[model samples]
Target: MWKPVPLPYKSDSLPLPAIPTAAEIRACTNVLWDGAHRIVALNEDVVVKYDGGLDATEGQNLIYLERYAPKVPAPRLYAMFEEDGKTYLILQRIPGVPLDSIWKSLTVSEKNGITAKLIPVFDAMREAACPWPDFYGGLDGGRVHHWLFYSQKKKDFKFLGPYYGEDAFVAGMLQNFRVSTERCERPDFKARFYEKYLPQVLRGHRPTLTHSDFHQKNILVIENPCPDNQGERSFEVVLIDWEDAGWYPDFWEFFMASDRNVFSFCDEDWFWHMQQFLEVWPAELGVMRLFEKDMRGH
Candidate 1:
């Protein structure tokens, strides 16, 4: 069971740990990426991830992966601590560069080969059965960070949901969506969304372990020394950033793969190949798009 740590400050309070000082990030060179919630830096061979008093799923996910899917290549968690309401994770950095960095340089065949390598990893995830099939949430028994709640809630809001199943999860989503769009005064649109899309999404799909953010940027690749015919080089694939991983409905993988927000490299070939490698749920995606548009008030 995962224990919830009380945030040091109230919800109304401003963000904590305002931009780590030089002394705080000691020996950490070459800032990797600074996003709204966390700042990631490279400290020699280790990667340091700092979260600004919000979100505990990253560390928890790492721990879960280390125990459950040891073969799946992810950054090994070395150390973790909380200071001044902020969370810091020290991880063993994977050696290769992000796949997206070299995506444009690779030939079509090379790209396809990389996808082939990833199939086994996906298979492993699919094979790993959920300990509690009744719930739909994170590995730590927390709420899933779906786009629906993410857009409406505060950054620090601990969205820990363990909805019973797809029906419960969708109900929660609909409720939250209503709250988010209460000001719009559009009940009919909500009704239309519920009537048209909800049934299609419900399709009696079983839950499977899903790397909810399996995108090109999250995939690391290193070229194999030996090259096959056609001069296409084989590569070792390492999936990273497991913060959003959880046991989700069968269609969740397809929905997330097609999500452009995280998967920036959603090119025609990549999208097509991802569908070929895994299941594609176009109807679910259409519903998600409707929700997205509604949230954006479009």
Candidate 2:
């Protein structure tokens, strides 16, 4: 005798957290972070981040890293879902203080040891397989998330990309630059110079996965967690906040890490430490700074 079994119909809906859990989240008083998104500590082991509008790619990026680049220390994503115009992501709570908190007190040798460990971690990330070999974008093959593709003229504009090649990516960047220069009260002569030289300046870079925001706050460190034979404490680092992680030009990691906006404010020698781990593209960085100036009006 043959009997037919029926299973529930499947749809593309994401998993939803328990109703009580969601309710508690909305009313949770233990907020870890308050910014564009709200991060609430659910318990000792987990935290949930929710926002009215968040880039879904961030969760995907975490999954991608865990799957493809396991050596890169990052948070474990427990659950992610969308409900009622808001997105919620439950994640493992990594135990460590932010690097910036104790950076000033670290001895030069200790700093060097910490950075030495990080160099290989970044190397592993760069070495991870690209989801789309020919395209530069988010892990899901969606639009690139970097600011270069952001539309300056449009309010809350959706960035453009998943470019098929380096040339196309450069074209997208120049298009945004043009929009930014258009209808300005004063003539932006630098815009004209960038229009002419940008293609040449931006040429010959292969796409690499970049954690575009690599600052002290985003990096967590556990100091003296383990002691070796000499009774010296070993340093450990875990990187967080993958919101801006994506495929970008090879030089992007260096450029973003070297930006001075935070140099005077937090971790004064952050740039110097960044230089130790990243390959310095002096000429490209200089040109990128000029472009950053044009884009930021500095």
Candidate 3:
């Protein structure tokens, strides 16, 4: 919902350190993450993430956060450019561990402390004024990046977004749904039922900013001992992976966070804690689960 401004990239500006080759990144010893892409720590202060399949919007989303939602703690993007069919993002190397790494060992008080700190981070996103009334999509009118918006077949894929209102947003979803139906060998008959149910279920919602990939793994936290209070610790939380961050229906954050695949654990404790911060939309989530089932032809 933050007001987005144009990026300052110019053709004449030099991209620092000269974008590296895939071979160079593979050879780097300080590699931090290696999955869909490679995240290499160039030094103590700087790191770079590069991949041929990376979304062009990832760096742009970081820039959006830096400018509009300053309070939302995220990595600082130093440089971003594409070379040899790969996108590279130079970022500030944050000093902390991913929340999921320590979730199981933390005491009850520590968990509550972390959860309390996270509430304000989300509030900063939710409380920001919408850039345009009823607009839903990526920053600066880019395409929406939710998992539901992705397709395996690029030739027939439609990247729908920047919808003007809830109606348009729902229409866009249905359009993508219809495309998926074409590929299904045995389409669910409930697709027709959902075609009517979805609009009503998703209707009358206002646009809100969402980190669509909200999960413990993307959250970085550092612990500090409180000098004045005995045995007390303070936590600093920073959100990472902004590729999926954008404006969407208010319920999208809770819905996306609750996804079991990304939530890291099927633990009911984690689920209960999430409800404390994210606005719960039981009906919407239930309906969307059905929508997901039909879309994937499960």
C-alpha TM-score for every candidate: 0.82, 0.86, 0.87
lDDT: worst 10-residue window of model 2? 1-10
Q: lDDT by residue for model 1 over 1-298, one digit each (tens)?
A: 4443342312222123233343566545567767744445554456667754445577777767777777677776655666766677666666788887897788888988898888888888878767775678887777786656553444545564678777777777676666666545566677556646676666687778888887788899978989986677889988887877887888888777777533444544677667656787777777776676766672
After superposition of all CA atoms, the RMSD between model 1 and the true structure is 6.5
**Once superposed on the true structure, which residue ranges of model 3 sit more than 4 Å away at CA?**
1-27, 151-154, 185-188, 225-230, 261-267
**Candidate order by TM-score, highest to lowest?**
3, 2, 1
Candidate achieving higher lDDT, 1 or 2: 2
Model 2 agreement with the true structure over 1-298: per-residue lDDT tens digits: 1111111111123233442256778898999888978888877877788884674567777777776789989987777666666667777787788988888887777788789889998888778767676578876567888787776675757888779898888878877777777745547677778878988878888888788888788889877666667555568899998988888888888888777433474636667777777777878888988888777772
Judging by TM-score against the true structure, name the best candidate: 3
Which residue runs does candidate 2 get wrong by more than 4 Å?
1-20, 153-156, 183-188, 228-232, 261-267
Order by lDDT, highest first: 3, 2, 1
By TM-score, how accurate is candidate 3?
A: 0.87
